[model samples]
Target: MSFEQFLFYFFSVVLVGAAVAMITVRNPVHAALFLVLAFFTSAAHWIMLEAEFLGILLVLVYVGAVMVLFLFVVMMLDINVARVREGFVRLLPVGLVVAVGMMVVMAMVVGARVFQVESPGRADGDYSNTKAIGELLYTEYVYPFEIAAVILLVAIIAAITLTLRRRPDSLYMDPAEQIKVQRKDRVRLIKMEAEKK
Candidate 1:
């Protein structure tokens, strides 16, 4: 087999293994780490397909930023593992069915060559996929792109709104309350008679 084919199979195996590990691992942090490995291998696959920009973006955006944020949140949050896994057995069959359906669809798409290219020739030396993508995005797909951005913004706002809660038991200092305080409010001078010690 060619070196390129060997590399493809090698990375594919790694990617699949990482993905499996990501889902099966009990520790969320370890799962996130496995996801990072999966992302790296996927990026390699993208680069092999001559989509260098997407490969780099997958690494930088997902692995570098998103995964790091995920890791931090996972580490910081007081997650109840037992509570989280309580529904796992109930959901297992549904999850497996969905997973199998997705695999079948993917296999069908690959076998049918649904995404076959019209021209398989290598791009010119001066050609830039980044520029082409930018032009297409800004020109033809701008509306959809803007809509996606707005949806993401709304999602972020919704997530923050959902997770934000005022805890009655937690103590918090209000800046306005702090600023309004006078010396008398904080301190009281006590007059006392001197006593012989």
Candidate 2:
């Protein structure tokens, strides 16, 4: 096998192992870190395909932003591993079924040689990856992209909503109440008794 083929197999093993570790790890924070490893390997695969933009985007958007956020949430939440694992035995069958079904579908698509390979060619001299992506995103795929954005926005709002709490004993000044206050409200004339301290 070629060096590239060997590298591909090596990273592919690492990617799958990391993914499995992400799911099976007892600690949520450790799981999240393994998930980062999975993302890194996937990005490496994309880079090997010469999709530099997509590889960088995968590293930047997923590994940088989304995975960091996931890791932070996992760490901050202090999730009970025992409680989470309680139902794992009951859910194992379903998980196995779903995994098997996905594997079958993937095999059908890929193992059947539906994707024919062409000889490697030199990179197009005039091709611009960013421009092509921009055109596709803004023109044909704009609606789907916008929908994804809205979904992400809603997810962010939902996460904040779920985590936010109010302290009943803590006093806070109302902005509207402050704005509506008059000079009389601000300054109270007090009659004080003069006393020797």
TM-score of candidate 1 on Cα atoms, chains taken together = 0.78
Top candidate when judged by TM-score against the true structure: 1
Give residue 36's error in model 2 in angstroms. Answer: 0.1
Per-residue lDDT tens digits of candidate 2, residues 53-110? 9989999999999988997777788678889989888899999999999999998888
Error of 1 at 177 (Å): 6.4
Q: For candidate 1, lDDT tens digit of each residue in 1-197?
A: 99999999999999999999988787888999999999999999999988899999999999999999999999999999988688778888998999999999998998786577575445568877788789989999999999999999999999999989899998999999999999999999999999999
Per-residue error at 146 for model 1, in Å? 1.6
Estimated TM-score per prediction?
A: 0.78, 0.77
Q: In model 2, which runs have C-alpha deviations exceeding 4 angstroms?
A: 109-123, 150-173, 187-197
Candidate 1 regions off by >4 Å? Answer: 83-89, 108-114, 119-123, 167-197
RMSD to true structure for each model, in Å: 3.6, 3.7
